[model samples]
Target: MALAPEPGPDWSAALSHLVLGAVSLHAAVRSAPASRGAAAGFLLQALAATCTLAPGLGTREDCPSGAWVATVIGLPLLAFDFHWVNGDRSSANLMLGAGMALAVAGEHLGPEGCSVAGQAVLLVVAVTIAIVAVFTANTYGVWGGALLGAAGLLSRLDEDGLPLRRGDACRWALAAGSWAYCRALRTQRLQWE
Candidate 1:
């Protein structure tokens, strides 16, 4: 028997991701030499968003959990870029290692088998990014990271517990967070210039 058709994908959320990716790609290209690390981080983030949009845009059959993993790996790159600017490389290597470890753990957990754990990993990375942003006085980063963390939490909520689908809420928050992150990159590029 033929299976029922799935609902159409969230077009607004997909559009936001597309915008985020484009802006981030622009940031990566326009960043100054001293801000190459941040540019690289932006590029990685863009890749993550691209992964998220792939299924929705019909480039893939399903969303890859690699999006979260990539975000996890990219967080420390951003956190350390500012740290490096401040002449503090002592914890940069350690954080980078930790980010990689977290990415591996998140991947192993698998969103289907353990969505909460996967989302929790996303929360951890997002919170770390927010904390780092606060320390660095990056307003956009602080808000963006917080929104991303909120999205993670929202995604874990039961569908029956809310008036609207939790997935929709999560997607809206994720898209907003992505826009904020793109703004963060823009601000960082300006500082570098």
Candidate 2:
């Protein structure tokens, strides 16, 4: 049998991801040239979105459970964006990327596994990023990181008993975050240029 298309939210989340990617790529071009890696950064974000939404695309059916794995893909995208904004791959980028990976890894683990580990990781990363965002006043980084984390967990809200399925909440969150993030990046690029 063919795989049924994922419902509206999944597609919408995917669409948001694509829009963010496109907007970022445009910002890079508008800034100046390809040297900034803006294209690469956005491409990575798009890749993360594709991976999250289409994990089971090549399989017999798309396994919705695998969608949370999008967090893993998000780590590299975060690192890339930081590099673009900072103009170099600083140690801070590496640390933040590792934290992102850990945070997502925790999401993948449940009570049946090592749940505490994951939550701790998520907390550390989230708090650290928020603090750094404030200290440095990197609005783009703050928005992107916050939204990326939100996308990772919020996508899993598809359980029963909730007012909205996790997927739907994730869609709206991703859509809003992606727009804000892209706007921040665009503004930053314009300022730099």
| lDDT of candidate model 2 versus the reference | 0.49
Q: In candidate 2, which residue pairs clash? A: 106-118, 157-166, 158-166
* TM-score between candidate 1 and the true structure: 0.65
- lDDT by residue (126-191, candidate 2, tens digit) is 444444455557686577558756755763455675556665555455545545555555655555
Candidate 2 residues lying further than 4 Å off, grouped into runs, are 1-38, 44-57, 60-70, 87-89, 92-132, 136-141, 152-162, 190-193
Scored against the true structure, residue 163 in model 2 reaches a CA lDDT of 59
lDDT of each: 0.66, 0.49
Residue 82 displacement (Å), model 2: 2.4
Over 4 Å off, model 1 = 1-13, 16-20, 30-34, 52-62, 104-118, 161-168, 185-193
